[model samples]
Target chain A: MLEYIVLGMVNYEDMTGYDIKKYIESGISVFYKASFGSLYPILKKLANKGLVAMYESNHGDRKKNYYHITDEGRKAFEIWLETPIMIDDGNGTQLVKIYFYDLLQEDKRRELLIRYRENNVTYLKGLYELEEQYVNTRNKDCYYYKLSVLYYGIRIIKETIKWCDDIIERKDLSEI
Target chain B: MLEYIVLGMVNYEDMTGYDIKKYIESGISVFYKASFGSLYPILKKLANKGLVAMYESNHGDRKKNYYHITDEGRKAFEIWLETPIMIDDGNGTQLVKIYFYDLLQEDKRRELLIRYRENNVTYLKGLYELEEQYVNTRNKDCYYYKLSVLYYGIRIIKETIKWCDDIIERKDLSEI
Candidate 1:
């Protein structure tokens, strides 16, 4: 996933590894984080796989490696963008996709958001049923705590659905 | 973290690895997941550390390995319960901590929730400031998508803070 995130970052513009790390920190550090230790290795691996290419550039007197996405990398990223998001993939993956949704065709963007919203709508039903079962039984000592966790899930998923609706209803992406 | 989750599970009851996996699936699969490959090794490590004791018991004709929390395990879990949860740890860790919060004292539980809520309240302010900066600049092509992701973070954090307030205000755990 970090590999794909790095790919998305470089797709925006050629960046030094340091630049990519800084971008992640400034942009999505709330839901995601990548450290220097982990980020550099993924950069190296992406270069090895031909998904990205590295070139040395001088920043003052120091040489820095800058990575740019290749044509192949762009194709890989597009495929990832077009792939259907699983309901259980968690928020970070979904956020990364939305962060790069501008790279997707406008129709594809709406399609994916609808699919994501529908998936959550269905999952929300299952959660309600689970809550019912818990309410019926109420045998465990951790019952309230468990229910609290479940409520957290329900609330977050509902918020995600609402977010999708707001984005989809907007007349234009730039109108915001 | 998986280690602590496993310890929390066994703290409830002596169960086989399969039971632990099933419990995680039913309980917190929304925010957390553990595959068999990763879980078995953690279980073994916990046993080696004297945090958990493993024993074999016959279930019908099959011998199953069941893990029970040791005195050391309970102390470790308690320490974790007492520790301050960092805001950047993400929702899964926070949910796990809350799921086992029943084991914490009443005052400790309230203290933790207040701390967690305050942390998010502070972070939400940062997010709003970020949104202001983005709205002012709006230079990037992915401006809308990036803002959407930022909005997602803001919404989720707000929901979390609400959840904390709801739980804190409840008169009793079992009242729900």
Candidate 2:
């Protein structure tokens, strides 16, 4: 999966490992993230497999290696893109916590639920701001589908906020 | 995390590794799942740490080890329950593919979007069925908040389906 992501980014433009990390953090961190530990190793493997070509350039005191996708990499990526997307049930930790929340006392459960709700509010606000930025700086060549992904993020976050509100509301009702 | 889940199930009642896996698959697999490989090891570690007590029971030429959470385990689970839940952005692979979708031909892109949309419809149907089952069961001790997690799953899948439709519609407009 990381290999495909690396190939996807390299397919966009030539990038050093650091550049790839930066790109993921800025644009796609909401849905995915990778640490340098996993990033560099995958990059090395991809380069060795001839899927990506690494070239080094010297810039004064530093040497940087940039990766460019090969013809084979593009073909592989195209095949991967055709594979159907699986519906992710999402990361399960939070849901598991909620299921077992009866273990906590009333005050503790309310505190956790409130904090979770607040976090979603903050996250949704950030997604909205990002969408606004994309709209304001719209590029004619920018594929509409690209922006649609951001909307996907925004919509889910909005639903999450609503879920949070409902949970908090129910907690209040139970008290009365 | 697996350990916490193991403790969570044991907190409910004494269960062997096989039982835990079965319970997760039937009840919470929508949000969480575990393989016996990881489950047994984590269970063993928990026993070693005195967080859970392992008991052996004989059942007609078979031996089963059941785990029971200790007092300390309950205390730990209580604290863990209070920990705030993080909002999952979901599996990033789908979003990542969408972001780079311009690399594909127009027809291929539409095909992928349509397939993705259909997959969400299937997922949404399953969630609705699960919700109905929960409502019908109507166990007095069944916590409302636990069912809210299923709602969260249903809501996100619905939003994802809508996003897929919007992208498909936008693609058609672009063709015009």
Candidate 3:
């Protein structure tokens, strides 16, 4: 959550609750998920904890709530930055989804495959473009991570596409 | 969750629940996560639904439950394979962590910095090994995706390290 918050800060300087959700979803792979229900509350908590400072502003007729990292927030972020994250054992969503894939009818599986392929293709193309964008604009440190993410995105899509082919070949689900 | 299940199927052809969990965490940079709290119930539900069928064995005086994908489960997985996933949006822990870095005391910030650096470096090294492993393996499609993840892993580490350096150069947080 903090990494994303800082990403918002890095990307937009200062933004409101709405901005964060928009930014993450637009390019943040299907694997990465967040909800506003938790986001707003988390923001409030961040402010309360003094990790983030909040403000209110009006744009046109709309009132907007804003948050920014405090110096204290930065310090805290730095500390978090230094810490190592352990890959604690937990549920794997991809596996669960696949496990139950057979529960869906053949047609449903086909629909899913088509949709998944389309999604991956679109995402991969966009990522390729983004790589160009980063290069064309000379985006530096702040932007390099985007490249990393994009690379992963494309790779996953390619692999998924291939996996779909393999499964189809092995099982011949369409014929069945 | 489905991905984890598939992982279980693919890794060693068949696995007990414990073996499944260990296989994923140790081998794949898997997207699956499961908890004992949820696993038993879900497993039973899957079995009930015919997505998975099970067998039991006694090992070292302990009862073991083993599951394998059924034709129905395979079909279900296939259908799911093609479906487009809805990627939920939400908080990024790293971003959130960065946002609040300023809240900590100087020593705390330094501590975070140290921890973050250690983590990134460790992960970065692991990524390098993965890349090499990918190079040596026949699963290029999967390895491609792994490489992509590693790419981001590297960029994120660089950013974190750079931030730590920036703090050291720009401020004297020691007295704070």
Candidate 4:
């Protein structure tokens, strides 16, 4: 819900669901994301709320639905923007996964820990590319803000990888 | 939803919703959140799923509804925990707020900007507390990851506050 609204309001002048999803995955949304399941549902809901309107374009075999923000939508977005919204589910799964890392057999837990590190590295690679885009664009101010988020991702991932390594090698989870 | 699930899984030993809420607020979930709304709904759903069972108690005008994780719920939470989840929400509300700063009347925008800074400061305050907690609880290996988030929030808020201050002093929006 937020990812599209943010995309519609920020990155591109306008976007379709596919475009938004692609943009999000392109490392632009290291902070925000909308899955296809969530994205399709939200687009319909936003249009119904009269904050967004969609137009269909014929692309031969593919008909494209492009969503544009309405005055009402922009206003609504701004209102939401102004409001103090608490982000829930901030890092629930990772913590839970760690909290229950003991649930797995020791070796399986060791393997999962290694895999998590690999995942972090993969994500950091995407962030690195996004950082280049922001820098090349020379929107230094905005780019820096994006970089700030990227840096945060890097730091956390580094920390996770380190923690997991220490856990796997450190003799015991109960001690640390 | 997650809060209740986590709480119920823990509470399989026995606990109250109040205890669950307090535990979450106590910085145990510095990364994620589970509010009463999400918690109550999840409790009902998990119960319906036969993953949890709830019993109500009337204690001095206070009704403490407690939840227990059934074996099914434990299995479900374990499965849910292992699901490969993603974390992101990269649409820039901060930039959205900055760009539209002009859309707001001069006085309103400045107030809004100040309010944003103030809010960021409050958020930074929380992060700082988490940083302290992480430092005390964990070794240096985890410091960078945890401290990085703290620094990210702190720096971004600092940058934003500085940006707003510069704009206010120079009356930059007059050009707009």
Candidate 5:
């Protein structure tokens, strides 16, 4: 996943390792995090795999290695983008895909959003059933803390569903 | 963190490795996850550390090893519960603390929630500042995808703030 994020970022524009880290911190830090320890190693591995090409650029007295996505890297990123969004995938996965949705065709983007909504709707139903079961049983009274945790899941999923609905309703994806 | 989670669960009641896994699936699967592979190793490590004790129990035709929290385990769990919640801590960390919050004194729990709210409030302010900067720059048109990702962070943080407010406003913590 880190590799894909790196690829996606470089697909947008060439970036030094520091630049990639900065973009991650500024853009997706809320949902995901990558430390320099992990970032540099992943960059090296991607370079070795021929997914990204690194070139050194000099600015004043500093020479920095800048990464640009190779043709292979772009293909790999597109595959990741089109992969189905599962109900159990982390929030970061969906967010990263949507952050690059402009690279996808409009129809494909709409399809992914609808699929995402459908998956969450199914998940929400399961959560409601679990809630009902917990309420009917002795667990509800003795385990309100666990119940609150469950409610947190329900609330977040509901919010995600609402976001999907709003995006679908908006006639223009660009405006979103 | 996995060790702490294991201790917290065993601190509640004696549970077999299977029981802990089931509880995690039902209770906090949304925010955190642990597979049996990792769970068994942690359980073994906890026992080795004298933080938890294991004993065999016969259930009809089957024998099970159940983990019980030791005196040391209880102390560790308490320290974790009282630790300050940071703005960048994952949602799982906060939820796990709250799941065992009943073990803490009423005053301590209240303090943690207040602190949690305060931390998120600070984070939300930074996000809003970033949003304003993004909107004011050329980023507004060309990078709406990135902006949407930023909005995801903002929306989730706002919901979290509201949850904190709701919890704080309720006169009774037990009802939460």
Candidate 6:
């Protein structure tokens, strides 16, 4: 997945490893992100596979290399775009934690749920701000497409907040 | 994560590796799952660490080993339950694909969104059935807590389906 993300990003514009990391952090950090530990190795493998080409540019005293998608890379990325998305069946840490939350007492469970809900609310606010920025931007061919993905993030967070509220409300009803 | 999950399940009952796999497959397979390749080694490591104790039981002609959580195992599991859930910054494969989807023609893009929405709708329907089942079950202490997680899944899928519909509808508006 990281490999394809790198190829797709380079297909947009040439980038060094540092640049790719920065772009992902700024843009799709909500849904997709890669760390330096994993990024460099995937870049090297992409280069070896002839999916991307690297060229060095002089930045003052330092020579920085940039990755650009090759013809083969473009072809491969097109194929990938047409492929159906994989069902995500793993790494749902939040839900997994909640599943075993019965180990805690009622008060403790309540405290955790409250805290988790607050954190999600805070995160959702940031996404809304991002949505505003994207909506206001003009003339980018990919604007709505990016907003579509952001909407997914925002809506999921909203649903989570609703779920959290329902759980808390049920607790209140029980107490009454 | 799988380690803690195995420990949590064994805490509920004595389970052999096969039983553990089956239990996860039937239950938390949505958010947490493991293949035998990863599961067996983790079990062996947990046993070596004395987090779980193994007992031999005869199953007809075969001797089967079952895992039971130790006192230490329960303590460890308790700590894990209280720990904050990790944020999932990676593996949003659908949104990642959608982000670059402008590269495709509009008709193709609409087709993908429709297909994506249909799949989400199907998955959400199954979750609703599971939610109904949980509601009807009696005498399960952790029933509501488990329902809370299932609700999260249902809500997210509903949100995704909505996003897909919104995008497809916007495309229709533009075309008209």
Q: Which is the leading candidate under DockQ?
A: 1
User: Which of the numbered candidates is closest to the native, going by highest lDDT?
Assistant: 1
For every model in order, the TM-score on chain A comes to 0.90, 0.51, 0.45, 0.44, 0.91, 0.51
TM-score of 1: 0.92
Compute DockQ for each candidate against the true complex: 0.53, 0.17, 0.04, 0.07, 0.44, 0.19
Q: Over the stretch A13-76, how does candidate 1's per-residue lDDT look in tens digits?
A: 9999899988887787776788899999999999999999999999899998999999999999
Q: Decide which is better by TM-score, 3 or 6.
A: 6
Clashing pairs in 6: none
lDDT of 1 by residue, B1-176 (tens): 88888999999999999999999988887778899999999999999999999999998999999999999999998898788777776445656788878777788889988998899899999988987778888775557778778888888888888888888875343333
TM-score of chain B of each: 0.91, 0.51, 0.42, 0.42, 0.91, 0.52
**All candidates' TM-scores?**
0.92, 0.52, 0.41, 0.38, 0.93, 0.53
Per-residue accuracy of model 4 over A1-176 as CA lDDT, tens digit each: 45335434432356788887774443223334567998888888888888788899877988898888888877675444333222233442223224223324566656665666676576557656755654676555423322343444444545555555766674332233
True contacts kept of 3: 0.08
Looking at model 5, residue B30 earns an lDDT score of 75
What DockQ does predicted model 1 obtain? Answer: 0.53
- Model 3 agreement with the true structure over A39-87: per-residue lDDT tens digits: 7888888788887888889899898997878777767654443333222
Q: What's model 5's overall lDDT? A: 0.79
Per residue, candidate 3 scores C-alpha lDDT tens digits across B1-176 of: 44435423532355676776554333232233455556667677877887777898888899888887777776665444333222222212222233223334566556655665566576557656655654676454432323333343345445545545655343322221
What is candidate 6's fraction of native contacts? 0.53
lDDT of each: 0.83, 0.67, 0.49, 0.51, 0.79, 0.67
Model 1 clash tally, residue pairs: 0
**Residue range B28-89, candidate 6, lDDT tens digits:** 44345579998889899999999999889999989998998999998887666544323243
Model 6, residue B155: distance off in Å is 9.1
Which prediction has the highest TM-score against the true structure? 5
Tens-digit per-residue lDDT, B104-141, candidate 4: 35566556556655665665575466556656776655
True-vs-predicted CA distance for residue B176, candidate 2, Å: 38
Model 5 lDDT, residue B94, Cα: 56
Runs with alpha carbons beyond 4 Å of true place in candidate 2 = A59-62, A88-176, B88-176
Candidate 2 local lDDT, A1-176, one digit each (tens)? 66787787898789999999996654333345678999999999998888999999887879999899999988887666444333234342223345435434567667777776676677557656765666677663554655665566656667776776777666432222
Candidate 4: which docking quality band?
incorrect
